[model samples]
Target: MAIDLEIWWLRCLSFIIVIPFLGPHLVAIWKMLKDLLFFMVIIAIVMIGYGVASRSMVYYPTVNNFTTEAGGSIDNSFDGRSVFRQIIYPVYYFLYGDFSDELANLDSNPDAGWSIADHVLLAVHMLFVNILLFNLLIAMFTKRYEKVHQETRTIWHSQQYLFTREYFTRSPFLPPISLIYDIYCLIRMFVFFIRRNYFETPVYQHTRVFKIIPKKRDTIKEWHNFEDAYTYEYAHDEVKALKTASMKSKSGSDSDNKDDTTTDDNDLNNTTNGLKQVQRSLTRLERIVEELNVQLEGAIEKKQNPTTP
Candidate 1:
């Protein structure tokens, strides 16, 4: 059976294009996550330094006992003996590393008094991880999120438009049947290209998927009317009318002042300065209006011949 296959072929191409763009969007999100990993590395370096220092000074000390006044020594082996067990384990616990184990051991050492070094290291860790790294991560995420959103927003919208158009225009409902229909469409499209000279065939122009289809002639006419009304010449005429109205009002006021015979020299000077100021302002406005008209005309020309670029 002969069927129109152009729409299906175009949809296929659109789907291919849109699906690959999703990968870039995912990559952008992954790129933003790198900052978080970098932040973690910084904290890990600090933790490693503290671990090494405390392990060297406290854990593997030359004298493993404290001397007392009675000429006896007391054993100082209450803390951990290894760097992993002493420094790393304690820091991990504070940072919620081993959640189940930490929860289980929460009540086991609640009454234990921390060493002076332990207190100082804890403060440093808190300042870096909780205060500095946390805020930096939030700022990095916000910045990256906006950048990624801006980059991918157009692609995402295009994908959505294609999806909606394809779904609404699809003929077959069931997946297996739809697959068969798609295959038939592809075959028909191949035959169509075979019938026509490949190089001589008309180039396909892709219509914007998101462009709203005008259902009524009246609506299209209305759009045409709007375009005509906002043309550069029409806008220029409107500005000119406003300028003429302003000039007429100024002349009328001047004539009224002339009729008043008691007008003083100071009043005349003030009126002259005010008229000069108004003239300057009007000239500035005219220049601005002229610039706007030029820009509008250039925009219209560019829009008319979009393929020039």
Candidate 2:
């Protein structure tokens, strides 16, 4: 009853954890599909054992054990065997007949008929499953142990004595094998200096090599206002000054034209008035000269009469 209850509890508990994490864990396992194949084969063996075990424990758990891929009908189960034989003894009997004499009591079963062939198959399955299990465990855990051990050894050896590398150079016509190490050192030094020079150069001066982004603090104010560059450079004050200068030049030209027109009109009026006065004075002089000529003729006649007397 305790075993049965435990089995039921484990089945239920697996769902509680597995239902949530099963997908991710399965993805992880699926990524390493080759490794998972070994686990799959072992699981298949365990499931087969379980099915036969169920037949013995509970009556007639489904008897379908044929796999299409393996292309062989596995003599998967037998009846009338003891509890140990139905569950576990068949596995040992198949793997090592070394256990056949030890667990012979398990062979007397009420199946189609228990045969030597069936025992050998069960033993082979068990051996394969066990080997798979051992190898998988080593692969998953062995590397971790090796890494820790290696680090400890390195520390111990490094503490005992300092390693002094004596570097030498090679020239042309020399055996390269003797100078391979020196060449490697030179290559490493070249790479180091190149990297150092690249990083130490000012990023602003060599913008093509690398772009230097201004910090958030520098860009934040400009971004918030979003000022137009053209608007800032060409202000209202500058435009207004240009317009005022243009208007003043036009006004000056108009004033000069008006003054010249007024002077021409004044000159024409003075010339017309002076021509009228000169005509009136010439007529008056003509009248005075006619009167003087008449007086002179009268005096000449009187003088001729006085001379005859």
Candidate 3:
């Protein structure tokens, strides 16, 4: 039963591996944590200072009365163990509006001067922590959230690429099967070492586990090329259809009344200008495609007729 429970916990924890795929907003949360760490340091400094001052003020009269006498040991309240309980914790809780306990016996102290000073100090501490520092932290978080929101799509793509690359570079099999694959790789490496052909194999070509498998880079490039070609063809067809429709509209408008001829001519001029801009853009795209094709052809030729080294 315990072993089954442990396995179930492990299965649940495994879902953490897919957290990056869940959303890009996690990046913002990470940034907020970093900001919070720095903020905590500042809060710690403020809390420690206030805590020590307040605790000392409260204990000063008691310590003074004890020191006035001879041969009596001071109480354990002044020891290190009491510092966190008496000072630090109270100040920390005070920040969250739990000040009633601290204020309840404030006026009961014998020294009016020390009690007044403690009150003033607590008021100042509250203003700094509740008003100033907390607001500043909120502003910092808001700025970081906005920045991450603006680039959410780009961040998501980068995260997906990293996740894909991580899995792609690892063994396709899991656990026991992966162990077998590792043994096979070790045997393959040993054979290459014995044959003294290890250094001669290119780093990229060394990962060819199967003889008939194509390179990942080549497959990705082919996919990208196909997508680009399809996009270009679709754009070209849409532009041609738009131009035809515009020309037909202009012709139909020309056959209408002469009073509206001026307005129609103005519309025709705008349409022509827009078409000209699109044509110029298409021409530039065609030039870029031609250059890429030329480069690809030269590369193919070089690969086919390699120069002897």
Residue 109 of model 3 has an lDDT of 67
- The 0-to-1 C-alpha lDDT of every candidate, in the order given, reads 0.59, 0.47, 0.74
Runs off by more than 4 Å, candidate 3 = 1-22, 61-81, 171-205, 208-309
Candidate 2, residues 156-257, lDDT tens digits: the string is 333222211111122333566648766776886677677668777433322122222334434634532343333333444444554565455545555577
RMSD of 1: 18.3
Better of 1 and 2 by TM-score: 1
Candidate 3's displacement at residue 271, Å, is 51
Question: In candidate 3, where is summed lDDT lowest over 10 consecutive residues?
Answer: 208-217
Q: In terms of lDDT, which candidate is strongest?
A: 3
Q: Which stretches of candidate 1 lie over 4 Å from their true place?
A: 1-28, 63-89, 97-114, 155-309
Tell me which residue pairs clash in candidate 1: none
Q: For each candidate, what TM-score against the reference?
A: 0.33, 0.21, 0.53
Worst 10 residues of 1 by lDDT: 57-66
| Best by the TM-score measure | 3
